[model samples]
Target: MLLSVFSCNSEPSIQDQMVDNPGDDGQNENPDEGEELSYKEKAFATYEMIQQLYKKGDLYKENFPEQNGDREYSYLWPYVGMLTAGNVLYELGYDREILDKQFTGLEEYYDNRDYLPTYQAYPVSGGATDHYYDDSAIVAMELINAYELTNESFYLERAKTVTDFIMSGEDSRMGGGLYWFEGQSDNCTNGPNCMKAANTSAYAAYVTSKMYQLTNNEAYLTFAKRVYEWTYTTLRDPSDNLYWNDINIGSEQINTTKWTYNAAMMIMSAVNLYEISDDQEYLDEAVTTARSAHSKFTKVTNGRIFYPPNDSWFNVELLTAYIQLSQYDSKTKDYVEVFKDNMDYAWENARNNEGQFYEDWSGNNEGRFYWLLHQAALVEAFGRIAIYENQ
Candidate 1:
């Protein structure tokens, strides 16, 4: 579902790139200015195009007539796509009728049998079940966003329910981090075993921080700190300040891959903690990681920033966190151009004839099949960029 972000192991000398919002002197703001398509327009175009993936208002596995036939993969990712893509549509000020269709698709993901949402569900039926803490946490965070968007209690209660389920996946394992899966999952040696993944735990921390803000619940804050510190201490790559992918508590195995989302969500969580606690240290941590990760992950193309193509769904956390960090850290504002340029390049070069962008924005792997998650990721990316431009 996710990938390990590959980066050179060698750490370069990192500077404190904290920003203070420079005053204009001809080197002003806005990167995608005067383009044929406004950033919002491009986002809206992609938003409308992605709705075609939904089947009877719900998206299932892509069942091309030749490839998988009509059989749905029934995986959890399409829901992630829907939640992300739906939020982008809302942020773009799309019509409520268009947004409601997405809302219904998202609503279709919940499993009502036990009043507990699971990972995978049939498209229309919304039944059949498996639970992944990471998957539900992704939904839990979006449920709060939906609650914000709709001002509805149903979304709020569901957010709380999903958060409760995420909590159930936690134990005092591996110096105190949450488990990756609720039970036995595919591709694991032992059945029903849990892996302490950095992305999952850090994302849960981020979600709990939001929940704390939502309810003013000290318990959520306490848990957030527990998860945050545990992730920070356990998975952080001290060499470069980036983060590792996962750790096997039983064997003490550490997957040293430096993933973007794991660090991005941690940065976002740190920003939230700083805002709530008024702690400068958290802000410093957020800014430092944002600066260092941006340098480590991006390459220059015709002097424009280019991100990795394999798993862009993870990039949403980075883009969203960057938008959040830029508001507080002036240093992060400079990177907005990098974000915008990537979007512009993706639109010009990576998009398919069908309007779906491949996961690989580099276009070297254009043959890779189209995925809703990839399109959803860019929708969120462009949506975040739209937010920055509006700000």
Candidate 2:
């Protein structure tokens, strides 16, 4: 895995190895400078891309034509993508029509859940052939967001059902942490089983916290705290802000070296926890992690913040972390500036002159769905940053 290969050896502290050139030398350069648009500008560009990609009545395609066989559809990817995108639109002062359509489509899918096949992809082909924890978690978040925006009890009930499905696992490695799929054999050895993915766990925690906020239910809060503890104790790297991608179920050592998205999830979880608890520890951890990630994976080089390893998706994840951390700690100008620089670099380099974006700087096409999803996530991050700045 990329994490294992990249983070094999321990490195210097992020403070000591901080990236030079956060902006022009000595001078405070505006984060939104030439060759890169501001966060709001980039968000508007992404919105235009979404408008161009989907037809008025057509369902969102999970992957582009190059990947996933021309135009394959996914039961959950489009819904999740639209959820993120719709949140961005709402922040941008767009009408509710777009969100309404996205939610209506999602509701139809959940209402007719039987038609969706289980484990349609490889690597995770064994499970219960029904709902998986990861998919259900995403569905739960989308439904909760729907309820938050619409004040609908139906959306709340649906979110609860999805959360309950995810919380129902019993296998040793599977129960404490959410599983990738239901009915996965006890003996199955896969990446998902080997690694307790921070993204899935964090999303589960985030949704649980939100549910608690809406209903004042202690159960949701308790579940969020439990997941947060598991994540912090098992997956986090205390010496540095970076997090391990996964953990060995039995040994409980860091399994996957580290990944950008995992760090992003950790930051988001910390933010959510801080909001609920008013605990400075969570906020401090979020700032530390974001700084560490920014110093190591992303650096300001040649007047731009770029991922040295050249995975553009990391840019998006790091941007999300920076925006989330900045909301609580406005003093983190360096981190926020790096985030804006990286976002600008990504928009400038990733997009073709004609406006299409490659999956990443590496130009791999196998994971277009992952790329698109992260793109939408970055857009949402920008919108959130806008809201924070205004507040």
lDDT of 1 by residue, 36-106 (tens): 87767777767667666534334544421114223444345545766766776676787666556665666
lDDT of 2 by residue, 1-391 (tens): 1111112122211122112211111211333335545566666666667656643343454433224233333345444666766756665677787677666655434533454332211112112223445556666776777787778798898777777665553234733654444544245464334445565576677778878888888988888888877777767787886776555454555554666766777787778889889999988888888778767676545556555433444455556666767767776667666555554544555444434444433222212323345456556656656655662
Q: Give me the displacement of residue 238 in model 2, in angstroms.
A: 3.1
Clashing pairs in 1: 19-330, 19-331, 184-192
User: Can you tell me which runs of candidate 1 are displaced by over 4 Å?
Assistant: 1-35, 53-57, 60-70, 113-127, 185-193, 367-369
List ranges where model 2 is wrong by over 4 Å. 1-42, 54-57, 68-71, 111-130, 169-175, 185-195, 250-253, 300-302, 308-317, 358-371, 374-378
TM-score of each: 0.84, 0.74
Clashes of 2: 1
